[model samples]
Target: MNDFLIPQHVNSFHRANPVAKLLCMILLFMLTLFTHRLDFVFYQMACFLLLLLLFSGHRFWKISLIILPFLLVFIASSSTMILFGKGDTVWWKWGLIQISQESFYRGIHIGFKSVTFAMEGLLFVLTTPSVALFYALMQKAKLPPKYAYSFMASIRLLPMVWEELLIRRNALRIRGVRSLRGGMKWLGILKLYMVPLLAQGIRRAHRVAVAMETKAFDGQGERSYYYPSEYSKSDIWVILLLSAAVAAALLMSILLPPFGITDVRYR
Candidate 1:
C-alpha cells in the first residue's frame, strides 16, 4: 500500500537531501510570513503551485485531491475576517456581521497567505519520504541516532497497527457482535476497541524497546546506516529552484499592478 502511494518517477526534489530541503522550506515559510502585500503573497502561491504541478510526479486527480482541503482553509480563514473585522469604510453591516473595504482586502490577503503555506507544505510532503527524512536528520543534521531510529520505528509500526484494528473488527463480526448504536456508541468503542488497542500498543512498544536495548541502540558508539543520507548535486538544485521561485515571485509582484495594498499590517 505504501509503495503504491509513492510516485514511481523520482524527481530531483525527491532525490535532494531531506535536511537541505527542510531548511529551504523553513526559509520560504519565514519569507511568506514577512510578506504583507497581497500581490506578493499571490505570486508566492502561484510559484508553489507551479512547482507542485511540475515536480510532484503524481496524476492530476491525485494532486487535486491532495490540495482540495486548502479550498476550505482559504474560505474559512477569509470569511471570519471579512465578516467581523474592523475597518473605516463600511460596505455592509447587519448587527455583528460587517463587511468593509479594508476588511475585504485584508481577508483576501490572509486567505492567499494561508493557501501559500499549505502549498509549500504539500510540496515538501509530496517530495520527501518519511524514512528518508529520519535518516537525513540523523546523518546530516547531527540528530541522535536513538531518537531518529525510534521515530522511524514508530512510523513503520503504524500500518501493522491499522491492520490489527481491521482484524479485530472482522473477528468481532464473525462472533456475531453487533456494534452499539446511539450516544452510547462512543462509550462502547472505548470499552471494546480502544482498551485492547492501547494494551497491544503498550506491549508492542515494550518489546521493541527490549530489542533495541539488546542491540545497544541507546549507546553512543558509531554505527553504519542501511540507507545512507548524503548531500549531492540534487540538493544544490533543490536550493536553486526554491531560490528562483522566491525571486520570481518578488519580480512578478513588483511588475504587476498593485492591489492598492502596500502593507496589510497598517490596515
Candidate 2:
C-alpha cells in the first residue's frame, strides 16, 4: 500500500512516457470490456498480474494478498447474480434465489471481467508516479496550469496530512490516552484527531500556495520542467503490441469457442 506513495525502480515502465502509459491502460480496459468470454478475461487478468509481478518490485504473494479481499468481494457479488438473474436451466432454487447454468456461466464472465479491470488499474497505479502523470497531462495532454498545479499540490500534501494524523495520535498517547485495540474507542480517537488535522491542513495549504507563488508559478504563465518527458518510439511500440494482443485474443475466442462463452447451459 505504501508503494502507491513511493514508486520503486523495477523496469522500463518507470521511464515510459506517462501520457502513453495512461492511454495504454485506458485502451486495454476498453478492450477488456469488449471481451465477452470468461477465458479471454482471465487471459487479460493473467497478463496484467504477470506484468505487475515483473515490474512492481513487490512479491507476488504480497500483492495478491493485498487485492485478495477485493477479488473475493467481486466474485461473491457477481456469482450472486447467478442466483437472482434470469437463466433457463434451474440448478438450485430457494426463497426466490435460483441458479441456472446460463446464469452461472454469466456470473463467471462478470466476475473475471471485474478482476481483469482491477488488476490493470492496480498495475497503472503501482507503476506510474502521480506527479509525473500530472506533469505529463500538463505537457502532453495540455491540461491547464491552474488545474495541474492544484492537482500536483494536492498530491504532495497527502503525505503531510497522514503525518499530521500520526503525530496527533502520538500526542494523545503521550497525554495518557491509551490506544484502543478496537470497539467504539476508535471513533472517539478519530474525532479527537480531526479538528487539529483540519486546521493543520489549512495552514499547510496556505504555506504551499505562498511557496508556489514565490517560485513564480503563476497559473497564466508558461512553466518549464526540470525533467524532460516526451513521447517516443517505445510508447508507440507499447500501444501497437497491446492492440495486437487484443486482436489475437479476439481471434482465439472465435477459433476456440469452448474456451469462451457457450450456447448450451450446464445440464
Say which candidate scores most in TM-score: 1
Predict model 1's lDDT versus the native: 0.87
Best by lDDT: 1
Report how far residue 108 has shifted in candidate 2, in Å: 1.9
Question: lDDT for each of the candidates?
Answer: 0.87, 0.74
- TM-scores for every candidate against the unseen true structure: 0.88, 0.78
Off by over 4 Å in 1: 167-192
State the lDDT of candidate 1 residue by residue for 50-101, as single tens digits. 9998888777788888888999999999999888888889999999999998
Weakest 10 consecutive residues, lDDT, candidate 2?
258-267
